[model samples]
Target: MPPLNSTNNTESENVYNCPPIKHVPFPRSTSYYLQSEITDEFLQFAFSFLAASFQFLHLYRTVWWLPDTHMHQTVNFHLIDKSVALFLLILLSRRFWYSICITCVDLMVTKKRLYRMRLVLRYVFFFVITILLGICCVDIYFKHNNRVVYMCYPIIVYVIIFHFNIEPFLRTVYEGDMIYINGSPLHCCSTNPSAIRTEIDSLKKDFNNRFKQVIFTTLFNAYYGSVIPCFFVQNFVFYDIWITTFHMAFVLVGGFTTSTMFCLPANYCDVMHRAALHLGGWTRIDHRVASPATPWSKTTVWPNGSVVKYSGDFYRSHGLTTTAIPSNSYDNKFYMFFQNPAHIYTILSLIQVVIIVTQLFVLYFATEWHQMLSLGFLVLCNYFTLFKMIRDFFLTQRIYESESNIYARNLSN
Candidate 1:
C-alpha cells in the first residue's frame, strides 16, 4: 500500500511540475487547401492542348462563320461564342473560387469579420466586371455594327486598366506580411532546410506547365481571331481586320509580359542558396595555391578551431541546404528558354516594336475615314503595349544587374 501511495505521489508531483501547455495558434499565412492536384507532366500537357484546341475552334468560328445575311445578324447569342466565353469565364474564375473557399475556411477558423467582408467586396467586384464584359460581348456580336463595337472598346479598355492598376493595392490589403517563397508558405518554425527548395521546384514546374498553356491559348486565339478571320470574310473590311488585330496584340502583350514575372522562383532559389552558405559560415577567398584570384574558392572555420576548405557539395551533405540552386543547365528545355528574364523581355520588346512598325506601315495605305480611325486606334493601343513592355524590360534588367553586383561584391570581400 505504501509503495503504491508513493508511486501515485510521484506521478502527481511530475504532473504538477510539468510546464504549462502552450497553445500555439495555427499559422494564418499557410493555406491548407490551396494546392494544385494535377502534378503529372503528360497530363498537364494534354490539358493544355485541349484548352488551346477549344480556344482556336471558338475564335475560328467567330471569324469565319458570320451570318450570311443582315436578317440573321439580329440574333444576339451564338452557341459557339457563348460556350467559349463560358469556358474562359470558368478558367479565370478558378482563382476567385479558390480565394472564396480559402476565405470561408479562414473565417471559420479565425473568426475574422473584416477580412471576410473585404473578400466579399472583391467577389462582388469580380462578378460586376464579368457581367459588364458579357454584356459588351453580346452587343458586339448581335449588332455587327462596327461603330457600336468601336464604342464598346472603351469599356473593355477601362476594365483592363482598372484590373492592372488596382492589383498592387489589393495585394497590399489582402496578403499583408505573409512570406510566400515562390507561391508557397514559408513556415516560421520549420527546421528542414530542404523543404522550401522542394516546394520551389514543384512550383517552378507547375508554373512552367501553366506558362505553356497560356502561350498556346494566346497564340491560337490571336491567329484564329485576327488573321484567319480577315482571310475568310467576304467583304474584307479593313476595320474588322484592324479591330481583331488590336485584340490579338492585346492578348499577346498581356500573356508574354505576365510570363516574364515567373523568373522570380529562380531569383528566390539564388537567395536561398546564398543564405545557406552564409549560415554555414562559408566565405569566398582568393586561393593563392591554386590560382592568385580563384573566385570560386571558399573557406570556413569550424567551431573546434579547424580551418576547412569550402565545397558546396560538402556543405549540402551536412543538411544545411539542397539542390535548389539555380544554374545555367536545366533538364527541361522549356525551363531553359524561360530561365533568363532579361533576355526574354528583350526579345519580347523587339517583337512588340516590329508589330508596331508593321501596323504603322499598314496605316499609311488606309484610304477610307473609318479605316484611318480604326488604324489610328490600333496604333495607339500598340504604342501603349510597347511602352509597357519597355518599362517591364528596364525593371527586369535593373533587378538582374543589382543582383549581379551584390554577388560580385560578396566574392570580392
Candidate 2:
C-alpha cells in the first residue's frame, strides 16, 4: 500500500461522500442535474410498479364490482369502489413524491446512515408492490365466475412470472454482483484503489449477468413476452368502457416506460467497458480496414511501438494484452472479454416488430372495447420502444466518440 499522506486522506474523504455517477443523459438538458439527484433504480422501480398497479388494480375493481349505476340501492357500492380507487391512486402518487424527496436528500445529505435508509425504503416499496400484486391475483381468482376468471387469467400468469423469479430479479437488479459474492463485505468506497476497482468490476459483472437474465426471462423466455400483451387484452369484455380505457392507458404507458429500464444495464456496461478500454489504451484497432492496399485485414499498434496483425494464429499464440502503462490506476484491471449485447438487442427488436405488427392487425379488426385496449397498448409500446432505440443509438454513438477522443489524445501523447 502507498504511504498515508494528506493526498491519500483527501482521496478517502472524496470516496466517503462522492455522489453516485450518472451515465445516461436525460432527454431534457435541465434534467441532467435532476438525474444525478435521484437514483435511477428507485425512479424506474417507482414508475414500473405504478404502471403495474394501474393495470392490476383497475382490473381488480372491474373484476370484483359491477359497473356504477346511479340507482339508489347501488349508489353506496359505487362510492366505496371509487373511494378505494382514489386512495390507491394517491398511494401510487406518493411513490413519485418519495422519489423527489430522495433526490433532495441525495443532493443535500451524504450521510452513510441516510444512504442506508434510502436502500431500505427502496426494498420496502419493492416488497410492498410484490405483495400487493399477489393480493390482486388472489382476489380475482377467488371470485369464481367465468367473466372474472377470463379477465384475470393473464394476471395469474403475470403474477406467476414475477413471483417465481422475483428473488433472482431483485438480486440481479438491486444487489448485482455487489452482494454476497463472498462472505466478506466489499465496500464500494474503499481507501485502497484496488478495492474500489474490485467493487466496480463486480458491479459490471452484475450488470451483464442481470441483463442476460432480463433478456431471457422477460424478452426471450418461453411465454413471458406474449403475456405482456395479454395483460392489455384480458379486461376487454368485462369492464365498462371508461374503466377499460383508464386501465388500458395506464398499463400501456407504464409498461412502455418500465420496459426501457430492461435495456439500461446493458447500455451502462457497454459504455463503461469502452471507457475502460480507451483509458487503458487496450482498444483493438483495425488497420487492415484503414488502408486501401490491405482492405480486409485488422491490425493494432501498441503504445510501445509493437505492431501486430489479426489472425487465428496470432490470437491463439498471443491472446489478449493490456497496456504496460498504468495511467488511471483507479479503474480496476478491466478486460474487454465479455461479448456485447448488441446482437441480443437486435433479436429483441425483431421480436418486438413482429409482436407490434400482429397486435396492430388485431386492433384494426377489433370491434370490442377490450380489443381496443390491446390496440392502444401496442401502439404506445411501439412508440416508446422506437424512441428508446433511437435514444440508445445516440447514447452509444456519444460513448464511442468519447472513447475515440481519449484514444487520440493518448496516441498524440
Candidate 3:
C-alpha cells in the first residue's frame, strides 16, 4: 500500500480500498481499540502496588531492624534520599521536557539569535547539574559524606518548581501552533493535499522524537532511582539481599510499564488522533494508514474498525473548520471505560489512596523521628498525587458527561 503522504486523489482512493490489516483475534467481549489501554492501566496498577509495598518494607527494615549506628556507618541515608528524590522529579517531569524542547524549536525558527543564546545557556546549565548529580552518586557509592553533594538537592527542587510554573506559559504561547505535537492549528476547509501530508509527517516525527526521549529518560531515572539506592544498603544478610532484589525488581517492572505499555500506547493514540483531525477526521483516511505507526506489539485493529468521534463544539474550540466526525454506534463498554479520562484518573486515585494509607500505618509504628519524617514526606507526595487525580477525575467526568448528553439530545432531535 502507498504511504499516507501520497498526494494523488486516485492513489489515496486506492489506499482506502486496501483491506484492513489483520491481527490475532482477541476475545469478542473486548474492543480491540481499547485492549492495549486497558491492559496497560491494569499493569500500571499492579506495578504501583508492588513498588509501594516494597518501599514500605524497605522503610520498616531500615528503621526498626537495623542498628542505628550500623545504619549510619554503613549508609548515608541523606544522600540516597536526595538522589532518589531527584530521580523521581525527573521521571515526573517528562511533559516539562517535552514542552521545553518544543519551545526551543519554536524559538529557533522564530527568533534565531535568542534561540542560540538560550540553547547554549540551557545546555551549560544541564551539564553542570548532571555533573553535580554524578558526583553525588559517586559519593554515595564510596559511602563518602561530602557536604557539597547537598547542593544538587536544592537545584533539583528549583527545577521541579520551575517546570510547573513555566509549563503553563509555554502552553499559552504555543496554543494553536503546529510547532508542537499537541498544538491544534486549524486548517482552512480547502487546505492543499500536499500541506496536509507535510503536516502529518511533521507531527509523526515529533511524536517519534518525544516517545524516544520518554523511554530513554525513564530508563535513566529507573537506574538512578531504583538501582543506585540499593547500593546504599549493605546487603550483608539474606533479608537485605531479598529486600534489595525485590525493590529493584519492582522498579524495573514499573519502568517497563511507564515506558512501553503506558506512555507509548497513549502517546501513539493521541498523535494519531490529532493527525486524523488534521486530515478532516477519520473518515478521510484509511485505517491502514495508521496501522504502521502504532506500537504493534501492544495494539490491534478494532474488529469492526474504530472511529474518531467529536462534536462541532470540539472543532470550534480547536479553531478547526472541518466538520465534526459523528460517534460510532458500536462503541462498547471496554471502549467507553478505557477512553474516559475520568475512569483512568479514578483508578490512579485509588492506587494513591492505598499507598498513602500503607505509609501512614507504617509511620504510626515508627520509633525514630527521622524515619517518621521520611514516611511523612512520602505520605505528602502520595497525597498530592491523589489530589491531582481526584481533581482531574471530577473535571473530566463533568466534561465528558456533558458532551454525551449533548450528543444524545442532538440524536433525539
Instruction: State each model's CA lDDT, in order.
Output: 0.39, 0.40, 0.41
lDDT of 1 by residue, 256-345 (tens): 433333222234323332333212222223344222221122111112111223342221111121222222123222223433355655
What TM-score number comes out for model 1?
0.40
Ranking by TM-score: 2, 3, 1
What would the per-residue lDDT of candidate 3 be over residues 144-224, giving only the tens digit for each residue? Answer: 456335334434543443343332222211232354332323322223434545555555454444455445444443454
Alpha carbon lDDT of residue 79, candidate 1? Answer: 32
Q: For candidate 2, write residues 22-117 as lDDT tens digits.
A: 223323332122233134444444444444443433343432233664343411233222322332443334434555655566667668678686
Query: Which sections of candidate 1 miss by over 4 Å?
Result: 1-193, 220-340
Q: Which residue pairs show collisions in model 3?
A: none
Best by lDDT: 3
Relative to the true structure, candidate 2 reaches a TM of 0.45
Query: Listing every candidate in turn, what is its Cα RMSD in Å to the true structure after a full C-alpha superposition?
Result: 16.2, 11.7, 14.3
True lDDT of residue 175, candidate 1: 31
Output the number of the TM-score-best candidate: 2
